[model samples]
Target chain A: MSVIYQRVALIGLGHIASSMFWGMKASGLADEVTGYARSAETRETAREIGLCDRVCDSAADAVEGADLVVLCVPVGAMGAVARDIAPHLKPGATISDVGSVKRAVIEAVEPHLPESVHFVPAHPLAGTEQSGPASGFAELFHNRWCLLTPARADATEVAKLRRFWKGLGSKVDEMDADRHDLVLAVTSHAPHLIAYTMVGVADDLQRVTENEVIQFSATGFRDFTRIAASDPTMWRDVFLSNKDATLEILGRFTEELFALQRAIRQGDGDHLHDYFTRTRAIRRGIIEAGQDTDAPNFGRGAHSTGRAE
Target chain B: MSVIYQRVALIGLGHIASSMFWGMKASGLADEVTGYARSAETRETAREIGLCDRVCDSAADAVEGADLVVLCVPVGAMGAVARDIAPHLKPGATISDVGSVKRAVIEAVEPHLPESVHFVPAHPLAGTEQSGPASGFAELFHNRWCLLTPARADATEVAKLRRFWKGLGSKVDEMDADRHDLVLAVTSHAPHLIAYTMVGVADDLQRVTENEVIQFSATGFRDFTRIAASDPTMWRDVFLSNKDATLEILGRFTEELFALQRAIRQGDGDHLHDYFTRTRAIRRGIIEAGQDTDAPNFGRGAHSTGRAE
Candidate 1:
C-alpha cells in the first residue's frame, strides 16, 4: 500500500507512541515519522532504539510541518501538550490522540487547538500490562478495535485518520465523545478500578497472611494482579479524566457487589448460582463475540506463545 | 518412571478428570485409568476421545479394584459419590479428591470412607474456562502446583501420590485442610465471586449499553468475564462449601472496595494513586515470585491447551 501521510509526528514516546511508531514504520504507511517526549531521557532512548526517523526536542518542533500529529501522553497532560504545540501546528494538519477517555480529552485539548487544525480523539483498545518505549511491539494493535470520537471536522480528514489505524491492523468505529466515555466506563474504566481495589485488598491481607497472598495467588487474585500491575500514572489520569462515568460505573458495581454479599451472608445458594450462571453466559458471549481468547493462562509462568520459562 | 498406582479410577469425566487421565497416562504414572461421569453421553465421549483406559458403567464399578480412587465430581456431589463407592474401594487404596475447597471435601468424603482406606483431600490449582470430557489434554498439569491436604494418611501413601504428581510435571505441596480453604478463599474464591459480580453488573446494565460493554471489554471487564465463565456447578459448590472463608474474604474485599469508592467519589486522587501504585507492586511480586507470566496477550484469541472445548 502507498503511504497515507507525507509526514506523521508522534508527540509522546511512551508505550502507545512507540507501538504506533513501530506499527506505522513496519507497515510502511508514512513517508517520515518524528517523535517527541517531555523527558530528554525518553527522547535519547527513542533515538538510541531507532524508534523514530526524527527525534525532536519539542512537541511544537515535531509537528511544525507534519500532516498528522498524535498526542499520546497521559490524559491529564493533553491540555498542556495541545497548548504548547498549537502555535506551531501546520494548517489543515489532523490532530488526534490515543487517550482512554474521549469527552475529557476533547474538552481539555479542543480549546487550545487552532481552528485550522482538526482534532479527532481516538482510543485503540489494545495494551499490555507493560509500558514504556521498550515495551511496545508492532503487532500490539493487530485485530484490535480503535474507537474514534471526532469533533465537527472535515469528513475526508476523519476518514484519512481511520484508514491510518486500519492500515495498522485495527478495526475502526466512530461514536460521539460522550457515548464513548460512558461505554469505556463500563468496559474498561470500572474493571480497572475493581482490579486495583482487589489487588489492594490482597496487599493489605499480606501482613496477616505473611506473603501467602503472593505464594498462592494462582487463583483468581492473580488475574487482578496482572491488570493492577499496569502503569499507575496512566491509570490515575484515566480515572481522573473520566471521573463522572467511572464513578457512575463504580456505583453500579458497588450496588451489585453488595447484593452478592447479602446473598452470601443469607446462605442464598440459589441467588449465587443464578448470578454465577448468568455471568457465565456473558463469558460465553465474549468468547463467541471473539472479544477474548478462551484460555486460563492467568498465573501460568508462560508467555503468550505458551512457552514456559 | 515407574507407575505409581496399579489402577486409578476417576469418578467424573469432566475437565479435571480427563486432564488427570491424560496427564497420568502421558507420564506413565498409572498402569490403568478408568473413569465414569453421571451422563452416558459423557461416558461415550470419554470412550470416543480415548480420555480413559476404561469408561465404566458405574462409579462403584470403576473404583472396585483401584489402587487410587479420585473423586473429580463437583463439591456438592462428593458426599454421594463417596458413599456410593465406599463399599467397593480396595482395602488399602488411597482415596482423594481434586476439589477447590479442601475442608468441605474432607468432611464430606472422610465420613463415608472405610477406616482401612486412606483419605486425602487435594486441590490442583489449575483449570481452564472450558468444561466436559472433550476439553482436556496431557499437559494440563505441567508446571502447575497441586496441594495435598492429607488427613491422618500414611506417610508412604502421601509420598507416593506426591511422586505421581511430580512425575506428571506438577509441583506438590502439603497443607492443612482449614488453611488451604482460607488461602484459596483469598486467592481463588473471592476473586471468582468478585468477577461474577462485576460481569453480572455489566450484563444488567440497560440493553443499549450492554453491547458496548462487550465490545470495549478489552480494558478490564474482559478478565472478569474469563474468570466468571468458569464452570457454574464447580463455583457454586465452592461458595456453598467454603462458606466461612469465602464470606470472610468477601467481607474484607467489600470493605476495601468501599474505601476505594469513597476515595473516587471524593476525588481523592492521592488515595487513588497510592492504592494503584501499591497494587502494581503486588503484581510485581507475583511476577518476581514466579507465580505468573509477564507477557500481555489479552486480545489474542488463543485457547488454553488442556481445556476441553
Candidate 2:
C-alpha cells in the first residue's frame, strides 16, 4: 500500500494509538508517525518500544507539520486534548479520533478544532481487553470494521482516512454519529456493562464463595469475566459520555431480562425455548458474515490439548 | 486406560452422551457402549455416525445388561427416562446422570431407581454450544471438570464412576448436591440466562436492525451470542429445574445492574470505575487457576491471519 499521509501524529498513546503506529509502519500507510501521551510513564514505555518514529514530548509538538492527527484519548478527555493542540495543527491537516462513542466526541472536540483543519470522526469496531502502550500489534484492526462518521465538509480528507484505515487492515464504512452511538450501545456498550454487572454480582455473593465462582466459571461465566476485565478508565468515560444511548439500551436489556425471569418463574419452558432458538439465528448470521468463526467453545479451545488418551 | 465398566449404557444421544461414547472408546474405558434417544431421528443419526457400539431401540433395551447406566437427558425428562429404564437396569448397576441441575435431578430420579442399583449423580463441566449426536468429539471432556454429587452413594460404585470420568480425561471432585445447584446457579445457569436475554434483546430492538447487530457484533456482544447459542432444550430444562437458585442469582444481578445504571445516570465515574476494576481481579483468578488461558482475545483469534503487510 502507498502512504496515505506524509506524516501522522497520534495523541494519547494507548492501545488504539499504539496499534495505529505499528500498523502504519507495517502497511506503509504513513511516511512518519509522531506520538504523545498525557502520562510520562506511558511516553517512556512508548519510546522504549519504538512505538513511533518520533515520540513527541507534547501534543502540540506531535501535531507540528503532521499531515494527519488522530486523537486516541478517552472520550471525556478528547475536548481538552483537542483544545490543547488546536492552535498547532497544520492548516491542511486531517484531524480524527478513534473514540468508542462518536456523537459525544464530536460535540466535545468539534468546537475546539480550527476551521483550517478538517475533522473526521471514526470509531473502529475492534479491540482486545488489553490496553496501554505495550498491548498493541500491527494486526489489532485486521478484518475489523472502522466506522467513519464525518459530519460535513472535507470529502477528500474522509476518503484519505478511509484508505488509511483500509491500509491498516480494517474494512471502513460511514454512518451518522448518532446512529453510531446507538448501534454501539446495543453491540458493545450495554453488553459490556451487563457483563461487568454479572461478574460483580458473582464476586459479591457471600453464600457462594468467590473461590467456587472462579473455579467453576465453566463456559458462560468465564466469557463475562473477560469482558468485565477491560480498561476501567476507558469504559468509565464511554458510559459517561455515551450516557443516553447506553442507558436506553440497558433499559431495554433490563426489561427483556425481567420477562425472561418471569418465564423461568412460571416454568414457561416453551417461551424460554423459543426465545433461545431465536438468538441462535443471530449467532449464525455473525458466523456467516465472517465477523466470527463457527468454532464451538470458541473462547478457550486452543490452549487445551486434552489428555494423552 | 483399562476398562472401568464391562458395559455402559447412555440414555440420550445428545452432545454429552455422544461425547462420552467417543471418549470411552478412545480411552478403552468401556468394553461395550449402547445409546438411546427419545427421538427416532436422533437414534438414526447416532447409528449413521457410529455414535455407539449399538444404538438401542429404547432406554430399557439400552440399560438391559449394562453395568453402568448414565441418564444423559435434559433435567425435565430425567424422571420419565429413569422410570422407563428402572425395571431393565442390571442388578447392582450404578446409575448416574449428567444433568446440569443436581437436586432437581436427584428428586426426579431417586424414587424411581431400584434399591439394588446405586445412584451416583455426576455433572461434566464441559461442552460446546453445538448439540445432537454429531456435535461431539472424543476430546470434549479433556482437561475439563466432572463434578460428582453423591448422596450416601455406595463407596465402590462412586469410586468406579469417578475412575470412569477420569478415564474420559476429566478431573473429578465430590461436592454436595444442594450446594452444587447453588454454585452452578451463580457460575453457569445465571450467566447463561443473562447471555440469552441479552441476545434476545439485541434481536428484538427495532431501532438497530438485526443485520447491523449481526455484522458489527464486535467482541462483547459476539461472546454473548456464542453462549446464547447453546442447546435450547438443555437450557430450558436447566432453568425450569434449577428454579430457586437461578431466580435468586438473577435477582442479585438485577440489583447490581440497577446500581450501575444509577451510577451511569448520575455520572458517577468513581462508582463505575471502582466496580469495573474489582471484576478484573476475578478474571485474573480464572486465568491463574488455569481454568482459562490468559489470552487477550480468547474467543476468536485463531482464524484471523492479516493482510500481506
Local accuracy of candidate 2 as per-residue lDDT tens digits, A81-180: 9999999999999999999999899999999998899999998877777788998778778888999999894898899999999999999999999998
Q: Which stretches of candidate 2 lie over 4 Å from their true place?
A: A301-309, B297-309
Candidate 1 residue-wise lDDT at B98: 91
Best by DockQ: 1
Over the stretch B1-309, how does candidate 1's per-residue lDDT look in tens digits? 788999999999988888888888777888999889999999998888888899999999899899999999999999999999999999999998999998888888888989999887788878878788988767777777899999689999999889988887778999988988888888888888888888988898883366777776774777778788888888888888888888887888878877877777787888888888888887778777776667655446453321211
Q: What proportion of true contacts does candidate 1 retain?
A: 0.64
Fnat of candidates, each listed: 0.64, 0.63
Deviation from native of the Cα of residue B285 in model 1, angstroms: 1.9
lDDT of 2 by residue, B186-208 (tens): 88899899988889989989999
Candidate 1 chain B: worst-modelled 10 consecutive residues by lDDT: B300-309
Candidate 1 residue pairs in backbone clash: B135-B307, B135-B308
